[model samples]
Target: MTMIFGIPIQAFLGQLLVGLINGSFYAMLSLGLAIIFGLLRIINFAHGAQYMLGAFIGYLLLADLGIGYWPALVLVPLIVGLFGMAVERFALSRLYGVDQLYGLLFTFGLALVIEGVFRYYYGVSGQPYAPPPLLSGGTNLGFMFLPNYRGWVVVASLVVCFGTWALIERTRLGSYLRAATENPRLVQAFGVNVPLLLTLTYGLGSGLAGLAGILAAPVYQVSPLMGSDIIIVVFAVVVVGGMGSILGAIVTGYVLGLAEGLTKVFYPEASNIVVFVIMALVLLVRPAGLFGRDG
Candidate 1:
Protein backbone atom coordinates (compact mmCIF):
# COMPACT_ATOMS: atom_id res chain seq x y z
CA MET A 1 0.00 0.00 0.00
CA THR A 2 1.27 3.50 -0.83
CA MET A 3 2.18 5.52 2.23
CA ILE A 4 3.07 9.10 2.99
CA PHE A 5 4.18 10.03 6.50
CA GLY A 6 3.23 6.51 7.61
CA ILE A 7 -0.39 7.05 6.52
CA PRO A 8 -2.05 5.95 3.27
CA ILE A 9 -1.84 8.73 0.71
CA GLN A 10 -5.47 8.20 -0.18
CA ALA A 11 -6.59 8.75 3.39
CA PHE A 12 -4.49 11.91 3.57
CA LEU A 13 -6.04 13.30 0.43
CA GLY A 14 -9.53 12.48 1.66
CA GLN A 15 -8.96 14.27 4.93
CA LEU A 16 -7.54 17.28 3.11
CA LEU A 17 -10.62 17.43 0.93
CA VAL A 18 -12.88 17.22 3.96
CA GLY A 19 -10.84 19.97 5.58
CA LEU A 20 -11.27 22.20 2.56
CA ILE A 21 -15.01 21.70 2.64
CA ASN A 22 -15.19 22.57 6.34
CA GLY A 23 -12.82 25.47 5.74
CA SER A 24 -15.24 26.88 3.21
CA PHE A 25 -17.87 27.24 5.91
CA TYR A 26 -15.35 28.68 8.33
CA ALA A 27 -14.21 31.30 5.84
CA MET A 28 -17.71 32.45 5.01
CA LEU A 29 -18.83 32.66 8.62
CA SER A 30 -15.67 34.40 9.80
CA LEU A 31 -15.82 36.87 6.95
CA GLY A 32 -19.31 37.86 8.01
CA LEU A 33 -18.23 38.19 11.63
CA ALA A 34 -15.30 40.40 10.70
CA ILE A 35 -17.51 42.65 8.64
CA ILE A 36 -20.11 43.15 11.36
CA PHE A 37 -17.54 43.62 14.12
CA GLY A 38 -15.49 46.03 12.07
CA LEU A 39 -18.34 48.43 11.54
CA LEU A 40 -20.76 47.79 14.35
CA ARG A 41 -18.21 46.90 17.06
CA ILE A 42 -20.69 44.25 18.07
CA ILE A 43 -19.73 40.62 18.57
CA ASN A 44 -22.86 39.07 17.11
CA PHE A 45 -23.48 36.01 19.24
CA ALA A 46 -26.64 35.30 17.24
CA HIS A 47 -24.65 34.69 14.09
CA GLY A 48 -24.87 30.93 14.55
CA ALA A 49 -28.62 31.13 15.02
CA GLN A 50 -28.83 33.13 11.82
CA TYR A 51 -26.87 30.40 10.11
CA MET A 52 -29.23 27.73 11.43
CA LEU A 53 -32.14 29.90 10.36
CA GLY A 54 -30.79 29.99 6.83
CA ALA A 55 -30.60 26.22 6.72
CA PHE A 56 -34.11 25.85 8.15
CA ILE A 57 -35.50 28.44 5.79
CA GLY A 58 -33.88 26.72 2.86
CA TYR A 59 -35.22 23.37 4.04
CA LEU A 60 -38.74 24.73 4.51
CA LEU A 61 -38.71 26.41 1.15
CA LEU A 62 -37.85 23.12 -0.47
CA ALA A 63 -39.80 20.62 1.63
CA ASP A 64 -43.07 22.49 2.24
CA LEU A 65 -43.29 25.06 -0.54
CA GLY A 66 -41.88 22.73 -3.21
CA ILE A 67 -39.18 25.25 -3.99
CA GLY A 68 -35.97 23.75 -5.28
CA TYR A 69 -32.37 24.28 -4.16
CA TRP A 70 -31.65 26.66 -7.01
CA PRO A 71 -34.29 29.19 -5.98
CA ALA A 72 -33.66 28.68 -2.28
CA LEU A 73 -30.06 29.62 -2.93
CA VAL A 74 -31.16 33.14 -3.84
CA LEU A 75 -34.29 33.56 -1.75
CA VAL A 76 -33.00 32.25 1.56
CA PRO A 77 -30.28 34.82 1.90
CA LEU A 78 -32.57 37.66 0.90
CA ILE A 79 -35.14 36.63 3.49
CA VAL A 80 -32.61 36.20 6.26
CA GLY A 81 -30.83 39.40 5.31
CA LEU A 82 -34.05 41.34 5.65
CA PHE A 83 -34.66 39.69 9.00
CA GLY A 84 -31.16 40.69 10.09
CA MET A 85 -31.75 44.26 8.97
CA ALA A 86 -34.91 44.33 11.00
CA VAL A 87 -32.98 43.06 13.99
CA GLU A 88 -30.54 45.91 13.58
CA ARG A 89 -33.23 48.52 13.18
CA PHE A 90 -35.60 47.34 15.87
CA ALA A 91 -33.20 45.87 18.41
CA LEU A 92 -29.44 46.31 18.02
CA SER A 93 -29.66 49.94 16.99
CA ARG A 94 -30.81 50.90 20.44
CA LEU A 95 -27.60 49.62 22.03
CA TYR A 96 -25.24 51.75 19.98
CA GLY A 97 -24.95 54.42 22.63
CA VAL A 98 -24.61 51.98 25.54
CA ASP A 99 -21.82 49.75 26.73
CA GLN A 100 -20.54 47.14 24.30
CA LEU A 101 -21.53 44.44 26.76
CA TYR A 102 -25.14 45.38 26.22
CA GLY A 103 -24.84 44.56 22.56
CA LEU A 104 -23.16 41.27 23.36
CA LEU A 105 -25.78 40.32 25.92
CA PHE A 106 -28.63 41.23 23.64
CA THR A 107 -27.24 39.15 20.80
CA PHE A 108 -26.54 36.25 23.14
CA GLY A 109 -30.09 36.41 24.40
CA LEU A 110 -31.37 36.60 20.86
CA ALA A 111 -29.42 33.45 20.00
CA LEU A 112 -30.99 31.57 22.87
CA VAL A 113 -34.47 32.70 21.93
CA ILE A 114 -34.07 31.70 18.29
CA GLU A 115 -32.57 28.35 19.14
CA GLY A 116 -35.22 27.64 21.76
CA VAL A 117 -38.06 28.42 19.36
CA PHE A 118 -36.63 26.06 16.78
CA ARG A 119 -36.07 23.38 19.38
CA TYR A 120 -39.66 23.64 20.50
CA TYR A 121 -40.97 23.23 16.97
CA TYR A 122 -38.47 20.85 15.39
CA GLY A 123 -36.73 19.16 18.31
CA VAL A 124 -32.99 18.39 18.16
CA SER A 125 -33.02 15.67 15.56
CA GLY A 126 -31.16 16.32 12.35
CA GLN A 127 -33.17 16.74 9.17
CA PRO A 128 -31.65 15.72 5.87
CA TYR A 129 -31.49 18.10 2.89
CA ALA A 130 -30.69 16.68 -0.51
CA PRO A 131 -28.50 18.30 -3.10
CA PRO A 132 -29.83 19.49 -6.41
CA PRO A 133 -30.27 16.83 -9.12
CA LEU A 134 -27.43 18.28 -11.13
CA LEU A 135 -24.96 17.70 -8.33
CA SER A 136 -25.97 14.18 -7.43
CA GLY A 137 -23.02 12.34 -8.97
CA GLY A 138 -19.32 11.94 -8.26
CA THR A 139 -16.19 12.41 -10.32
CA ASN A 140 -13.40 9.84 -10.38
CA LEU A 141 -10.21 11.79 -10.02
CA GLY A 142 -7.36 9.37 -10.82
CA PHE A 143 -6.50 9.01 -7.13
CA MET A 144 -9.79 9.77 -5.46
CA PHE A 145 -13.48 10.03 -6.25
CA LEU A 146 -14.72 13.55 -5.58
CA PRO A 147 -18.39 14.26 -4.94
CA ASN A 148 -19.68 16.90 -7.32
CA TYR A 149 -21.48 18.85 -4.63
CA ARG A 150 -18.42 19.01 -2.41
CA GLY A 151 -16.41 20.31 -5.31
CA TRP A 152 -19.05 22.93 -5.96
CA VAL A 153 -19.00 23.91 -2.31
CA VAL A 154 -15.25 24.51 -2.40
CA VAL A 155 -15.50 26.54 -5.59
CA ALA A 156 -18.50 28.55 -4.46
CA SER A 157 -16.97 29.35 -1.10
CA LEU A 158 -13.76 30.56 -2.71
CA VAL A 159 -15.67 32.79 -5.10
CA VAL A 160 -17.77 34.24 -2.31
CA CYS A 161 -14.76 34.88 -0.08
CA PHE A 162 -12.78 36.61 -2.81
CA GLY A 163 -15.80 38.59 -3.93
CA THR A 164 -16.37 39.80 -0.38
CA TRP A 165 -12.71 40.75 -0.01
CA ALA A 166 -12.81 42.71 -3.24
CA LEU A 167 -15.96 44.49 -2.19
CA ILE A 168 -14.45 45.52 1.13
CA GLU A 169 -10.94 46.31 -0.09
CA ARG A 170 -11.33 47.67 -3.63
CA THR A 171 -14.78 49.18 -4.08
CA ARG A 172 -15.88 52.75 -3.35
CA LEU A 173 -18.74 51.78 -1.09
CA GLY A 174 -16.31 49.61 0.79
CA SER A 175 -14.06 52.63 1.16
CA TYR A 176 -16.91 54.44 2.86
CA LEU A 177 -17.42 51.46 5.15
CA ARG A 178 -13.79 51.43 6.11
CA ALA A 179 -13.77 55.15 6.72
CA ALA A 180 -16.94 54.98 8.75
CA THR A 181 -15.43 52.25 10.87
CA GLU A 182 -12.71 54.66 11.73
CA ASN A 183 -14.80 57.74 12.37
CA PRO A 184 -18.54 57.60 11.78
CA ARG A 185 -19.15 61.18 12.94
CA LEU A 186 -16.60 62.55 10.48
CA VAL A 187 -17.93 60.36 7.69
CA GLN A 188 -21.44 61.51 8.51
CA ALA A 189 -20.27 65.12 8.32
CA PHE A 190 -18.94 64.37 4.85
CA GLY A 191 -22.54 63.47 3.82
CA VAL A 192 -22.29 59.70 4.03
CA ASN A 193 -25.32 58.15 5.68
CA VAL A 194 -23.37 56.33 8.36
CA PRO A 195 -26.45 55.03 10.16
CA LEU A 196 -27.88 53.43 7.03
CA LEU A 197 -24.47 52.07 6.19
CA LEU A 198 -24.24 50.45 9.61
CA THR A 199 -27.61 48.80 9.15
CA LEU A 200 -26.65 47.51 5.71
CA THR A 201 -23.32 46.25 7.00
CA TYR A 202 -25.03 44.13 9.63
CA GLY A 203 -27.50 42.92 7.02
CA LEU A 204 -24.71 42.00 4.67
CA GLY A 205 -22.93 40.05 7.40
CA SER A 206 -26.13 38.25 8.31
CA GLY A 207 -26.75 37.52 4.67
CA LEU A 208 -23.33 35.93 4.39
CA ALA A 209 -24.18 33.68 7.32
CA GLY A 210 -27.42 32.74 5.58
CA LEU A 211 -25.59 31.83 2.42
CA ALA A 212 -23.23 29.61 4.40
CA GLY A 213 -26.16 27.89 6.06
CA ILE A 214 -27.80 27.22 2.72
CA LEU A 215 -24.60 25.77 1.38
CA ALA A 216 -24.16 23.63 4.47
CA ALA A 217 -27.68 22.22 4.38
CA PRO A 218 -26.87 19.60 1.76
CA VAL A 219 -23.60 18.68 3.50
CA TYR A 220 -24.84 18.47 7.09
CA GLN A 221 -28.17 17.79 8.72
CA VAL A 222 -30.35 20.80 9.42
CA SER A 223 -30.88 20.82 13.16
CA PRO A 224 -31.58 23.40 15.84
CA LEU A 225 -28.19 22.88 17.48
CA MET A 226 -26.20 23.26 14.28
CA GLY A 227 -25.40 26.95 14.73
CA SER A 228 -24.20 26.65 18.31
CA ASP A 229 -21.96 23.75 17.35
CA ILE A 230 -20.03 25.66 14.69
CA ILE A 231 -20.05 29.22 16.02
CA ILE A 232 -17.43 28.60 18.73
CA VAL A 233 -14.88 27.44 16.20
CA VAL A 234 -15.77 30.42 14.06
CA PHE A 235 -15.20 32.75 16.99
CA ALA A 236 -11.80 31.22 17.45
CA VAL A 237 -11.17 31.72 13.75
CA VAL A 238 -12.14 35.38 14.10
CA VAL A 239 -9.87 35.86 17.07
CA VAL A 240 -6.97 34.18 15.30
CA GLY A 241 -7.57 36.05 12.06
CA GLY A 242 -8.01 39.41 13.73
CA MET A 243 -11.42 40.96 14.25
CA GLY A 244 -11.42 43.55 11.47
CA SER A 245 -9.01 42.14 8.91
CA ILE A 246 -11.10 40.62 6.15
CA LEU A 247 -8.30 38.78 4.41
CA GLY A 248 -6.95 37.47 7.69
CA ALA A 249 -10.27 35.92 8.57
CA ILE A 250 -10.46 34.13 5.24
CA VAL A 251 -6.93 32.80 5.47
CA THR A 252 -7.12 31.72 9.09
CA GLY A 253 -10.36 29.88 8.52
CA TYR A 254 -8.94 27.60 5.83
CA VAL A 255 -5.65 27.12 7.63
CA LEU A 256 -7.22 26.15 10.92
CA GLY A 257 -9.66 23.86 9.19
CA LEU A 258 -6.84 22.09 7.43
CA ALA A 259 -4.91 21.90 10.65
CA GLU A 260 -7.88 20.36 12.37
CA GLY A 261 -8.19 17.79 9.61
CA LEU A 262 -4.55 16.82 9.74
CA THR A 263 -4.79 16.49 13.47
CA LYS A 264 -7.62 14.05 13.04
CA VAL A 265 -5.43 11.86 10.89
CA PHE A 266 -2.27 11.91 13.02
CA TYR A 267 -3.56 12.70 16.49
CA PRO A 268 -7.23 11.86 16.68
CA GLU A 269 -7.64 12.76 20.33
CA ALA A 270 -6.27 16.28 19.85
CA SER A 271 -8.32 17.10 16.77
CA ASN A 272 -11.05 18.90 18.65
CA ILE A 273 -8.75 21.22 20.53
CA VAL A 274 -6.22 21.87 17.78
CA VAL A 275 -7.82 25.09 16.56
CA PHE A 276 -8.02 26.48 20.07
CA VAL A 277 -4.44 25.46 20.77
CA ILE A 278 -3.31 27.32 17.66
CA MET A 279 -5.46 30.24 18.71
CA ALA A 280 -3.84 30.39 22.11
CA LEU A 281 -0.37 30.30 20.58
CA VAL A 282 -1.26 33.05 18.18
CA LEU A 283 -2.67 35.17 20.98
CA LEU A 284 0.39 34.68 23.12
CA VAL A 285 2.75 35.69 20.36
CA ARG A 286 0.72 38.49 18.85
CA PRO A 287 -2.33 39.67 20.73
CA ALA A 288 -3.59 41.56 17.69
CA GLY A 289 -3.58 38.34 15.59
CA LEU A 290 -1.54 37.38 12.57
CA PHE A 291 -2.86 40.18 10.31
CA GLY A 292 -4.31 42.63 12.77
CA ARG A 293 -2.95 46.16 12.91
CA ASP A 294 -1.18 47.08 16.13
CA GLY A 295 -3.06 49.53 18.25
Candidate 2:
Protein backbone atom coordinates (compact mmCIF):
# COMPACT_ATOMS: atom_id res chain seq x y z
CA MET A 1 0.00 0.00 0.00
CA THR A 2 1.42 3.37 -1.02
CA MET A 3 1.45 5.87 1.80
CA ILE A 4 1.02 9.61 1.63
CA PHE A 5 1.98 11.51 4.77
CA GLY A 6 1.26 8.45 6.92
CA ILE A 7 -2.12 7.81 5.27
CA PRO A 8 -2.70 5.35 2.48
CA ILE A 9 -2.84 7.05 -0.93
CA GLN A 10 -6.21 5.53 -1.58
CA ALA A 11 -7.50 6.96 1.69
CA PHE A 12 -6.05 10.39 0.91
CA LEU A 13 -7.46 10.43 -2.61
CA GLY A 14 -10.80 9.22 -1.33
CA GLN A 15 -10.99 12.16 1.03
CA LEU A 16 -9.85 14.50 -1.71
CA LEU A 17 -12.62 13.16 -3.95
CA VAL A 18 -15.10 13.78 -1.18
CA GLY A 19 -13.77 17.30 -0.89
CA LEU A 20 -14.17 17.90 -4.62
CA ILE A 21 -17.72 16.60 -4.52
CA ASN A 22 -18.62 18.93 -1.69
CA GLY A 23 -16.77 21.73 -3.40
CA SER A 24 -18.76 21.21 -6.58
CA PHE A 25 -22.01 21.83 -4.75
CA TYR A 26 -20.50 24.75 -2.89
CA ALA A 27 -19.28 26.40 -6.07
CA MET A 28 -22.62 26.15 -7.86
CA LEU A 29 -24.59 27.38 -4.87
CA SER A 30 -22.31 30.26 -3.88
CA LEU A 31 -22.11 31.26 -7.52
CA GLY A 32 -25.89 31.61 -7.57
CA LEU A 33 -25.90 33.73 -4.42
CA ALA A 34 -23.05 35.82 -5.73
CA ILE A 35 -24.82 36.41 -9.02
CA ILE A 36 -28.06 37.53 -7.40
CA PHE A 37 -26.39 39.79 -4.86
CA GLY A 38 -23.90 41.12 -7.33
CA LEU A 39 -26.43 42.10 -9.91
CA LEU A 40 -29.65 42.64 -8.01
CA ARG A 41 -28.38 44.02 -4.72
CA ILE A 42 -30.74 41.70 -2.91
CA ILE A 43 -29.83 39.00 -0.43
CA ASN A 44 -32.20 36.18 -1.35
CA PHE A 45 -32.79 34.05 1.69
CA ALA A 46 -35.29 31.99 -0.33
CA HIS A 47 -32.42 30.42 -2.19
CA GLY A 48 -32.32 27.31 -0.03
CA ALA A 49 -36.03 26.94 -0.49
CA GLN A 50 -35.53 27.16 -4.20
CA TYR A 51 -32.93 24.44 -3.98
CA MET A 52 -35.27 22.21 -1.98
CA LEU A 53 -38.01 23.02 -4.39
CA GLY A 54 -35.86 21.81 -7.24
CA ALA A 55 -35.16 18.50 -5.58
CA PHE A 56 -38.81 18.02 -4.76
CA ILE A 57 -39.90 18.94 -8.25
CA GLY A 58 -37.42 16.51 -9.70
CA TYR A 59 -38.65 13.85 -7.34
CA LEU A 60 -42.22 14.49 -8.31
CA LEU A 61 -41.40 14.41 -11.97
CA LEU A 62 -39.79 11.04 -11.62
CA ALA A 63 -42.35 9.51 -9.27
CA ASP A 64 -45.41 10.77 -11.09
CA LEU A 65 -44.59 11.61 -14.68
CA GLY A 66 -41.81 9.11 -15.42
CA ILE A 67 -39.38 11.85 -16.19
CA GLY A 68 -35.81 10.70 -15.86
CA TYR A 69 -32.71 12.38 -14.54
CA TRP A 70 -31.66 13.77 -17.87
CA PRO A 71 -34.94 15.54 -18.51
CA ALA A 72 -35.18 16.66 -14.94
CA LEU A 73 -31.69 18.03 -15.18
CA VAL A 74 -32.84 20.42 -17.87
CA LEU A 75 -36.45 20.99 -16.91
CA VAL A 76 -35.88 21.48 -13.20
CA PRO A 77 -33.74 24.54 -13.66
CA LEU A 78 -35.99 26.03 -16.28
CA ILE A 79 -39.01 25.56 -14.09
CA VAL A 80 -37.29 26.92 -11.03
CA GLY A 81 -35.83 29.77 -13.02
CA LEU A 82 -39.26 30.71 -14.24
CA PHE A 83 -40.60 30.55 -10.71
CA GLY A 84 -37.76 32.79 -9.61
CA MET A 85 -38.65 35.26 -12.34
CA ALA A 86 -42.21 35.32 -11.17
CA VAL A 87 -41.13 35.94 -7.60
CA GLU A 88 -38.84 38.71 -8.72
CA ARG A 89 -41.57 40.27 -10.76
CA PHE A 90 -44.45 40.07 -8.34
CA ALA A 91 -42.86 40.06 -4.90
CA LEU A 92 -39.19 40.98 -4.95
CA SER A 93 -39.59 43.64 -7.60
CA ARG A 94 -41.89 45.57 -5.29
CA LEU A 95 -39.32 45.57 -2.48
CA TYR A 96 -36.68 47.35 -4.47
CA GLY A 97 -35.79 50.89 -3.34
CA VAL A 98 -37.00 49.98 0.15
CA ASP A 99 -34.94 48.84 3.11
CA GLN A 100 -32.82 45.79 2.32
CA LEU A 101 -34.30 44.24 5.47
CA TYR A 102 -37.65 43.99 3.72
CA GLY A 103 -36.24 41.86 0.93
CA LEU A 104 -34.35 39.69 3.39
CA LEU A 105 -37.37 39.21 5.60
CA PHE A 106 -39.64 38.45 2.69
CA THR A 107 -37.29 35.82 1.22
CA PHE A 108 -36.76 34.26 4.63
CA GLY A 109 -40.49 34.03 5.08
CA LEU A 110 -40.84 32.57 1.63
CA ALA A 111 -38.30 29.92 2.50
CA LEU A 112 -40.25 28.91 5.60
CA VAL A 113 -43.47 28.70 3.68
CA ILE A 114 -41.98 26.54 0.95
CA GLU A 115 -40.25 24.28 3.43
CA GLY A 116 -43.41 23.96 5.49
CA VAL A 117 -45.44 22.85 2.51
CA PHE A 118 -42.81 20.34 1.46
CA ARG A 119 -42.49 18.93 4.97
CA TYR A 120 -46.24 18.63 5.20
CA TYR A 121 -46.25 16.50 2.08
CA TYR A 122 -42.88 14.69 2.05
CA GLY A 123 -42.58 14.41 5.84
CA VAL A 124 -38.87 15.22 5.75
CA SER A 125 -37.59 11.66 5.70
CA GLY A 126 -35.96 12.04 2.25
CA GLN A 127 -36.40 10.46 -1.17
CA PRO A 128 -33.90 8.37 -3.05
CA TYR A 129 -33.03 9.37 -6.62
CA ALA A 130 -31.19 6.82 -8.67
CA PRO A 131 -28.48 7.94 -11.02
CA PRO A 132 -28.98 7.34 -14.72
CA PRO A 133 -28.12 3.87 -15.99
CA LEU A 134 -25.25 5.23 -17.99
CA LEU A 135 -23.62 6.64 -14.88
CA SER A 136 -24.43 3.76 -12.56
CA GLY A 137 -20.96 2.34 -12.01
CA GLY A 138 -17.50 3.34 -10.85
CA THR A 139 -14.14 3.49 -12.58
CA ASN A 140 -11.05 2.34 -10.80
CA LEU A 141 -8.27 4.89 -10.82
CA GLY A 142 -4.72 3.90 -9.92
CA PHE A 143 -5.35 4.74 -6.29
CA MET A 144 -9.11 4.78 -5.83
CA PHE A 145 -12.43 3.79 -7.30
CA LEU A 146 -14.19 6.79 -8.85
CA PRO A 147 -17.94 6.78 -9.21
CA ASN A 148 -19.14 7.82 -12.64
CA TYR A 149 -21.90 10.02 -11.33
CA ARG A 150 -19.54 11.76 -8.97
CA GLY A 151 -17.10 12.44 -11.77
CA TRP A 152 -19.94 13.75 -13.91
CA VAL A 153 -21.00 16.12 -11.15
CA VAL A 154 -17.52 17.60 -10.95
CA VAL A 155 -17.22 17.99 -14.70
CA ALA A 156 -20.69 19.45 -15.10
CA SER A 157 -20.17 21.96 -12.31
CA LEU A 158 -16.85 23.21 -13.64
CA VAL A 159 -18.30 23.53 -17.12
CA VAL A 160 -21.32 25.44 -15.96
CA CYS A 161 -19.39 27.67 -13.56
CA PHE A 162 -16.75 28.61 -16.10
CA GLY A 163 -19.32 28.88 -18.85
CA THR A 164 -21.25 31.33 -16.69
CA TRP A 165 -18.08 33.26 -15.97
CA ALA A 166 -17.37 33.50 -19.64
CA LEU A 167 -20.91 34.63 -20.38
CA ILE A 168 -20.69 37.48 -17.90
CA GLU A 169 -17.12 38.52 -18.58
CA ARG A 170 -16.83 37.93 -22.30
CA THR A 171 -20.18 38.60 -23.89
CA ARG A 172 -22.02 41.73 -24.98
CA LEU A 173 -25.14 40.83 -23.04
CA GLY A 174 -22.99 40.42 -19.97
CA SER A 175 -21.63 43.88 -20.56
CA TYR A 176 -25.14 45.22 -20.49
CA LEU A 177 -25.85 43.37 -17.26
CA ARG A 178 -22.81 44.82 -15.53
CA ALA A 179 -23.58 48.23 -16.89
CA ALA A 180 -27.20 48.06 -15.79
CA THR A 181 -26.19 47.18 -12.28
CA GLU A 182 -23.80 50.09 -12.30
CA ASN A 183 -26.28 52.56 -13.78
CA PRO A 184 -29.74 51.28 -14.54
CA ARG A 185 -31.10 54.64 -15.53
CA LEU A 186 -28.25 55.17 -17.94
CA VAL A 187 -28.70 51.72 -19.39
CA GLN A 188 -32.41 52.30 -19.69
CA ALA A 189 -31.68 55.53 -21.48
CA PHE A 190 -29.60 53.46 -23.84
CA GLY A 191 -32.75 51.37 -24.53
CA VAL A 192 -31.97 48.50 -22.19
CA ASN A 193 -34.73 46.97 -20.13
CA VAL A 194 -33.11 47.13 -16.71
CA PRO A 195 -35.99 45.66 -14.75
CA LEU A 196 -36.29 42.74 -17.13
CA LEU A 197 -32.57 42.30 -16.98
CA LEU A 198 -32.65 42.13 -13.20
CA THR A 199 -35.49 39.65 -13.32
CA LEU A 200 -33.62 37.38 -15.69
CA THR A 201 -30.47 37.65 -13.61
CA TYR A 202 -32.32 36.54 -10.48
CA GLY A 203 -33.88 33.71 -12.43
CA LEU A 204 -30.49 32.63 -13.63
CA GLY A 205 -29.23 32.59 -10.07
CA SER A 206 -32.16 30.54 -8.85
CA GLY A 207 -31.79 28.20 -11.78
CA LEU A 208 -28.21 27.52 -10.83
CA ALA A 209 -29.37 26.59 -7.36
CA GLY A 210 -31.92 24.22 -8.82
CA LEU A 211 -29.36 22.67 -11.08
CA ALA A 212 -27.17 22.05 -8.09
CA GLY A 213 -30.06 20.49 -6.27
CA ILE A 214 -30.84 18.04 -9.01
CA LEU A 215 -27.23 17.09 -9.54
CA ALA A 216 -26.99 16.48 -5.81
CA ALA A 217 -30.08 14.30 -5.62
CA PRO A 218 -28.24 11.10 -6.53
CA VAL A 219 -25.26 11.95 -4.38
CA TYR A 220 -27.32 12.86 -1.32
CA GLN A 221 -30.82 12.32 -0.07
CA VAL A 222 -33.51 14.46 -1.63
CA SER A 223 -35.24 16.11 1.30
CA PRO A 224 -36.81 19.40 2.27
CA LEU A 225 -34.04 19.77 4.82
CA MET A 226 -31.32 19.15 2.26
CA GLY A 227 -31.17 22.75 1.12
CA SER A 228 -31.12 24.06 4.65
CA ASP A 229 -28.26 21.74 5.54
CA ILE A 230 -26.10 22.95 2.66
CA ILE A 231 -27.23 26.55 2.27
CA ILE A 232 -25.51 27.75 5.41
CA VAL A 233 -22.20 26.35 4.22
CA VAL A 234 -22.78 27.80 0.80
CA PHE A 235 -23.37 31.18 2.39
CA ALA A 236 -20.19 30.80 4.32
CA VAL A 237 -18.48 30.01 1.03
CA VAL A 238 -19.91 33.19 -0.47
CA VAL A 239 -18.75 35.26 2.48
CA VAL A 240 -15.22 33.92 2.47
CA GLY A 241 -14.98 34.31 -1.30
CA GLY A 242 -16.17 37.88 -0.96
CA MET A 243 -19.91 38.35 -1.17
CA GLY A 244 -21.08 38.95 -4.74
CA SER A 245 -17.70 38.20 -6.22
CA ILE A 246 -18.34 35.52 -8.82
CA LEU A 247 -14.74 34.47 -9.25
CA GLY A 248 -14.22 34.58 -5.53
CA ALA A 249 -17.33 32.51 -4.91
CA ILE A 250 -16.16 29.78 -7.29
CA VAL A 251 -12.62 29.63 -5.97
CA THR A 252 -13.37 29.81 -2.26
CA GLY A 253 -15.95 27.05 -2.49
CA TYR A 254 -13.47 24.49 -3.80
CA VAL A 255 -10.69 25.73 -1.51
CA LEU A 256 -12.80 25.51 1.65
CA GLY A 257 -14.19 22.15 0.59
CA LEU A 258 -10.68 20.78 0.14
CA ALA A 259 -9.72 22.27 3.49
CA GLU A 260 -12.72 20.65 5.11
CA GLY A 261 -11.92 17.26 3.59
CA LEU A 262 -8.28 17.45 4.66
CA THR A 263 -9.40 18.50 8.13
CA LYS A 264 -11.55 15.40 8.35
CA VAL A 265 -8.45 13.42 7.57
CA PHE A 266 -6.21 15.27 10.05
CA TYR A 267 -8.73 16.33 12.70
CA PRO A 268 -12.14 14.80 12.33
CA GLU A 269 -13.53 16.92 15.15
CA ALA A 270 -12.81 20.14 13.26
CA SER A 271 -14.15 19.06 9.89
CA ASN A 272 -17.60 20.44 10.43
CA ILE A 273 -16.45 23.86 11.61
CA VAL A 274 -13.58 24.40 9.21
CA VAL A 275 -15.52 26.51 6.75
CA PHE A 276 -16.90 28.71 9.49
CA VAL A 277 -13.43 29.11 10.93
CA ILE A 278 -12.20 30.33 7.58
CA MET A 279 -15.14 32.70 7.33
CA ALA A 280 -14.38 34.22 10.71
CA LEU A 281 -10.75 34.73 9.83
CA VAL A 282 -11.59 36.23 6.46
CA LEU A 283 -14.13 38.57 8.01
CA LEU A 284 -11.64 39.79 10.57
CA VAL A 285 -9.04 40.55 7.96
CA ARG A 286 -11.27 41.74 5.13
CA PRO A 287 -14.96 42.28 5.56
CA ALA A 288 -15.33 43.19 1.90
CA GLY A 289 -14.54 39.53 1.22
CA LEU A 290 -11.68 38.01 -0.71
CA PHE A 291 -13.07 39.24 -4.02
CA GLY A 292 -15.58 41.90 -3.05
CA ARG A 293 -14.89 45.46 -4.12
CA ASP A 294 -16.66 46.84 -1.07
CA GLY A 295 -14.95 47.33 2.28
Q: Show how many residue pairs clash in every candidate, following the order shown.
A: 0, 0
Point out where model 1 deviates above 4 Å.
none
- Model 1 per-residue lDDT tens digits across residues 208-234: 999999999999999999999999999
Best by lDDT: 1
- Candidate 2 similarity to native, TM-score: 0.98
**Candidate 2 ranges with C-alpha deviation above 4 Å:** none
lDDT of each: 0.94, 0.92
Task: Compose the digit string of candidate 2's lDDT tens values, residues 1-295.
Answer: 9998999998888998999999998999899999998888888898998988888889899999999999999999999999999999999999888998999999999999999999998898989999999999999886799999999999999999989988888999989999998999999998999999999999999999999999999999899899888889999999999878999999998899899889988899999999999999999989988988874
Error of 2 at 30 (Å): 0.4
Poorest 10 consecutive residues by lDDT, candidate 2 = 286-295
Candidate 1 vs. true structure, TM-score: 0.98
